[model samples]
Every structure is written in structure tokens, then in C-alpha cells.
Target: MRTRRLIIGVIIALIVIIGAGFAFGALHKTKTNAKTVTLGIMPGGKQEDAIWKVVKANAKKSYGIDLQFVNFTDGDQPNKALASHDIDLNAFQHYAYLKSWNQSNHGDLVAIGDTIITPIHLYSTQYKSVDALPDGATIAIPNDLTNESRALHVLKNAGLITLNSSQGLQATVKDVKSNPKHLVIKEVDASQGPRTLPSVAAAVINYNFAQSAKIPASDSIFVEPFNADSHQWVNIIVANKKDRNKQIYKDIVSAYNSENVKATIEKEYPDGGEKAAWDLKF
Candidate 1:
């Protein structure tokens, strides 16, 4: 009986020592020291980088989190890295994209917080507007499962196509109920949408790709509108399911949504290109 009580006392002491940082840092809602977290993101966006500049700096100052970043060139890599514990967090994909990824991989990743949504828009070089496109004209859109669905929904909202009502967020060309002009949609990699603009009548381009191609907002023919139902499009901070409730992740979210970070986002996309998702109600 004495040995068992001694073992129990030792376990309690160990718990206290392990939890000491959390107890002392409870006021800040983060560990009191410089705990490192590896974040994965796709490189090359000015706005995202600017926002993160603020997030990274402030995370260290306010929460003692040393935010390190790993830039992934491939669109499919960030989540894969997060799943394998190669990364602590990722801030590239939206909720719908994450959901599809989870379903396809049978993985258990969860969004810890909302980030920003850099919306996709239709851009054209030959045509001035969606109404000006010639009949049976070719349109280019993202070929991936999540973005293809999103691009189709954008076209449907622009009155160029009618999608099957039951298709929900993953609509495809086959789900188009009507295509009155017989327009041909060329499915290309998401990054190639802007490059296809000079050839196709119009291309549905993700905001990041358009920015990368230096296509200004004025060059777009149609912009996708946001609504209460557009929650799926909002970008998110993601982590392994086991880490979803970690206080450090919560601190990171708070850091990202701080006033300074939000102001940086507003300054970067002042023309309404990409807005912070903190205040957006789903």
C-alpha cells in the first residue's frame, strides 16, 4: 500500500511539473516560453505573406510561440505534411477543400480557425465582360476536384451555367443543368488559369494565381459574390485532429485574427481582393 501511494504521489508531481508552463501562462493563453510551431503554406502570395509577417511577429511577442514556416510548392503537399506530423499547422486550404481531402484520404484533420478567402474571379483578355463572350466560347477553370466545383458554382452564379441543385459544393461540368451558349470549359491546373486568358474567352482564376500573373482586379470580367452560404470558401488554419483543442493552436488563431494582422490584410487587399475572415459569420 505504501509503494502504490508513493507511485501515485510521484505521478502527481510529474503532472504538476509538466503543466507548470500552462499554469503560469494561463493569463496569455499560451506557453510562457518560446514554443516552436511549424506552419506550412504555399509560397508566392504578397497579401498572405504580409499578413503572416504580422502574425509571426505578434505570435512571439504576445504568446511566446516561435512561428516557423515551410513553403510548399505543390498544392497537395501542405495537408499531406500536416497529416504526417511534418508540420504543426497549415493555412492554405478552405473548409470544403479540407473536407474533400479528409474524405479522400480517410484522414482526421480539422480546421482550428478561419483565415482569409481570396476569391476566384473570371478574367478575360478578348472579352470585356461575361455578357460579351461569343457563343460556344472556350472557358478555362481549375481541374482539381475542389476548385473545379467552386469554379462551376461561380459560373452558375454569373448566369452563364445552371448546375444540378443536388450537386452542392462539389459541382462539375456533368452537373451543369444548362449551358445555353454551348460554351466549352477547359479544365486546367489552377495556376494556369491566368495564362489561358489570352487564348480562352475567359478563365475562372483563383485570386492567388491572378495576383501571381499580375492580373489586376480591373481585368476581371466577373467576381464571385459571397453570402451566408459561402462559408465553405473561407480559408482556415488546420491541424491534426488530436491537436485541434491545443491551447497553442488557439493562441495562434488569436494572433492571426489580431487587429494588426487584420489591418495588414486590409492594406494588402484594399480593393476587396482578399479580406480577413475573422468577422465573417458563417
Candidate 2:
């Protein structure tokens, strides 16, 4: 009985020491210094780079926190890097895209605050106006669910097509209840839509894809309207769920939504006087 009791006490002491060591190490690491935050963005384009410049400058001014900007060449790359901890946050996607990614990937990425929506645009190679297109005109739209529906919505709003009332934002060609123009709609990958423009009558392209392909926003035939209802679809700064409320997160959002940032976005992705890339709702 005495031997068993002594062994049990030793084991208990050993476990306590191990637990205390882990606690101390964690505390020490956390206290070492303010962490540098890395922000992931889409590869440098005139519009996005201009906006990030404002954000980086503001973050430095507001919190004395260093914002390191990393660039990804595609839509999915930022999220992938964030999941791997190669980046601490990202600011290139909107809530709709972010939500779809989270649902499909079964990941816990969350938007910390809203940015702006780079408006989906319909650009044409053969015509300057939506009504001038001839019958059987070939129009291109993003093949993915999120952007495909947004393109279809633009068509519906233009009175070129009618979608089933129940179809909502996920509507596809099959959901088109009316196609008065007999438009031949082709679904291409989002990034490829702009390149397809020279071949098709028009292509409904995402803003990032358009910018990357050097398609000017001022040259597009149509753009999505910026309104409060579109706020959820506007671009956002996102972070892992664990880091949503950290000081760095607030600083990032603050930097992106500042007046300086707003003016830059306007010059970058403007429609009328509004910055179509972000709603400025935050």
C-alpha cells in the first residue's frame, strides 16, 4: 500500500510540472512582442494595389502594427494560403465567395468586416450597348455558381432574360424563363471570361478577372449597381475564426475603410461617383 501511494504521488507531481511548463511557455511566447500580420491579396492589379497601398499606410499610422501584403495570382490561392498559416488574413474576396468557399472546403474562415464589391461587368467586343446585340449573340458568363448567378441577374435586370422567381442568385441558363433575344450564353471559367470577350458578343466578367486581363471598367457595357442590398456581396477583409477580433484585424478593417482608401478605390473601380469595388457601408 505504501509503495503504490508513493508511485501515484510521483506521477501526479510529474504531470503538474509538465502542465506548468506548457502554460509558462505559452505565456512567454505571447508576451514576446506584437505579432506582425501578413495580409494576402490578389496579384497586383492597378485597382487592388492602389487600395492596398491606402490600407498599408493607414494600418501603419493607426496602430503601429506592420501590415505585410502578400499577393496570390488566383481567387482560391489566398484562402489556401490562409488555411496553411502562410498568411494571417486576406482582403480580396467578398462574403458570397468566402461563404461558398467555407461551405465547400469545410473550413472556418470568417469575414471580419466588409470592403467593397468590384461590380460584375458585362463587356462586349461587337457592340457598345446591351440592346444593340443581334439575335443569337454569344454572351459569356462565369461558369461558377456565385458569379454565374450574378451575371444572370444582370441579364434579368437588363430585360434580356427572365429567371424563375424561385431561382434567386443561383439561377442558370436553365432557370431562364424568358430569353427574348435568343442570346447564346456560354459559361466560361471566371478568369477566362475577359479573354473570351474578343470571341463572344459580350462577357459578364468578375471585376478581379477583368482587371487582371486588363479590361478597363470604363469600357464595360454594364456594371452591377451599388446599393445597400448589395452590401453582403461587397468585398471583405477576412481572417480565421480564431483571429477575428484581434487588434490587427480591427486595424486592417480600419485601414481599408478609411476615406483615403475610399478615394483610391473610386479612382480604381468607379461607376459614376461610387467605388463599385466596395460599398463603403462599413
Top model number, lDDT: 1
Off by over 4 Å in 2: 1-35, 84-86, 189-200, 208-219, 227-232, 268-282
Q: List the candidate 1 regions with Cα displacement exceeding 4 Å.
A: 1-34
Q: What does candidate 2's lDDT look like per residue over 204-279, in tens digits? A: 8876677668786556887776553355577778898998888768877877777887778668755532353543
Lowest lDDT sum, 10 consecutive residues, model 2, at 273-282
lDDT tens digits, residues 1-282, model 1?
999999999999999987996676685654445499899998856667788999999989998889999999998899999999999999988889899889989989999999887778998888788899889999999999878988898898889999888977778888989998899989999988888888888999988788779997777889887764367999999999999999998999999988888888889888778888878755
Go through the candidates in order and give each one's C-alpha lDDT. 0.87, 0.79
Which residue pairs of candidate 2 clash? 116-235, 116-277, 116-278, 117-277, 117-278, 118-277
Candidate 2 overall lDDT versus native: 0.79
TM-score of each: 0.79, 0.74
